[model samples]
Target: MPIGMILWRWDYRSGAEELGKYPKELDVSDKTMMQLYSQHLYGAQSDIVSMYVGALNIISVWTGSTHNYFLSLLLTIEEQPEDYKEVISDLLYYLIPFIEEDTFNTLLPSIYQRCTEFPSTNLEQRRAMMYGSNLNRAIFKTLSEEGCFYRDELKIWLEDILKTKLYNFEYIIDGLVQNDILKTSIVRGVDGTYVFLLKYLICFRAPPLDLSQKIKIAKDNELNQKILKKIRDFFKKYVPNEQDNIEIAGYIRQTNYWVIIDFLRKSYAKHSSLTKLKLHGVDQVMNLVNNLINSDIVDIVVDQNEEQVYFLKSDIILDFVPMNYMINQIYNMHVEDRKPDKLLLSYISILKENYLESH
Candidate 1:
């Protein structure tokens, strides 16, 4: 089920300047901020209720503002009993969904900092922020199933979160696109289905590093071997016979290897490099490594037996965590209502399987 009405609280001081700068005078009294917060909180809740009344759906309550006065108190919600009790009471009495402790912990600081940059004047901008806000919630919900999102899925997700059209959504998309942090393209499926693509421009950063440069960096980094091996294993297990050696190698060369390695270690430490080899067999492992080297994703210096080797150049590992997290969230949203597009699901499923296997 979708999260119930969520209540988020922030300090009023963090955004005091913006609030002061608001063209219209905001009801700034202590009671006024509380009332405004409660109003928005309840409004969101009511909207959810109207949409799913009498259904077995959850209602989440989130509270907080980007005010400085509330900062210390907000920080205490998770660890301080009195603060926690107060927030809990506020939520419980409203029959709202209780924010998970970890989630609350994750969100508090972010909201606090974000409120400081409150450009509340533009309605479109505010709506865009709200849309992005939901993405964070979605990420928390989806961390396990997929590891990347196709562009079309992102467009749909933005629509749902913003409750608006693509034309209106351009405000946010433009920023991401201009930053080179996001890319939109047309992708052709094996079945002849064509779709728009939204993906992180990990390899398209400023002063773009060419494929060979990336591969050289990867070779120089010792971690590429482990990452390449993981990628190969992932494909072998879930996407057998579908390996795009060039594409996979290129991705690795463009990616940030150390970061990927760190994330892999954190998420799947039990299946470390050594453990994977023992389970998958030595020859299979060797062949995969050889493929990566042959693809020029890595430069390898091998011993006489051609067994023991080291990478001489390689690319930095691009961060795919956000993509992965987005995929998981979409998966969960699909599970709740089964509304995610099939093509999107298929693409992400492929990504998830490969990522999980590689890790």
Candidate 2:
């Protein structure tokens, strides 16, 4: 039978409980397409590749519900006995590139979970790891190569996934730290988490920064001295001299930045405009504030009196809607099970009324 015929059977598989299973004739030959054709099994040999391509094209054009159902079947198929595994694996290799990102994310965690679940045999376990890792690497490559606009989105997704996998930091230290995936090429456009990982390897395992160089960074500046003191104290306490200290400093910086961002976020929600951030109260987080300003997420104005005022950027309000609106919508959705997106969009529609009028 033609490959397309097999796929048609698979797609319209009748029994819900046996969703992914199909006739064994589809798995008859592991040989090349030409070999199958030469044997006069499925008519022309070229039909093998052509039919498989046709099935993929059909799947790609499926509506959301149909696409989801197809994924469900593939997921089920992968978990079937080893004899049926190659078909699912081959299909995933071709299909994953065409899968919508949201769908890929939805299916990936479950696939990963299965990979980690206990296997009946050593061979099965190895196969699980091989397939799982290949899928991960493929997804990462696709996302990273996807354009500049998606860089941060991919980074955030990877960081979230890695966090779930690496229950303890040591797993990263022992495993991924030395991996080529974290090498500069792969992490080029991403953000903090990857940077922190590389830094950890350098600071802990690489030669410690020269004492003189460290002193130079701290100089006679009071703020520099204070920040350096905190960083040094963290490293001294947590870093083994023989290991890397980079992650410790990074963890401190990340935590400090998060705290500052959280404070500003809450303040922005409660009061759309902030006349003062009390920077003096969080001098250690000055770097984060400067970074925020550069990113245009927050606006800081210094008046003639030298008093500082901070507000969420107007574009943020227009793009994401107000935090207050989000909170209220979330509450209604939780309690009343209302659709918040429509309401949120309506609020966002009118959000810039005053700003536009003033301009």
Estimate candidate 2's alpha-carbon lDDT, on a 0 to 1 scale: 0.32
lDDT of 1: 0.35
State which candidate has the highest TM-score: 1
lDDT by residue (tens digit), candidate 2, 154-217: 4455556555322112222223324422222223233322211111111222112342254455
- Candidates' RMSD to native: 19.0, 24.0
**Model 1 C-alpha lDDT per residue in residues 253-282, reported as the tens digit of each score:** 221232232233322222235236434323
For each candidate in the order shown, give its overall lDDT on alpha carbons.
0.35, 0.32
- The TM-scores of all predictions, comma-separated, are 0.21, 0.20
Per-residue error for 18 in candidate 1, Å, reads 22
lDDT over C-alpha atoms for residue 334 of model 1 = 72
Clash totals, every prediction: 52, 6
Once fitted onto the true fold, the runs of candidate 1 whose alpha carbons sit more than 4 angstroms away are 1-156, 159-301, 304-309, 312-359
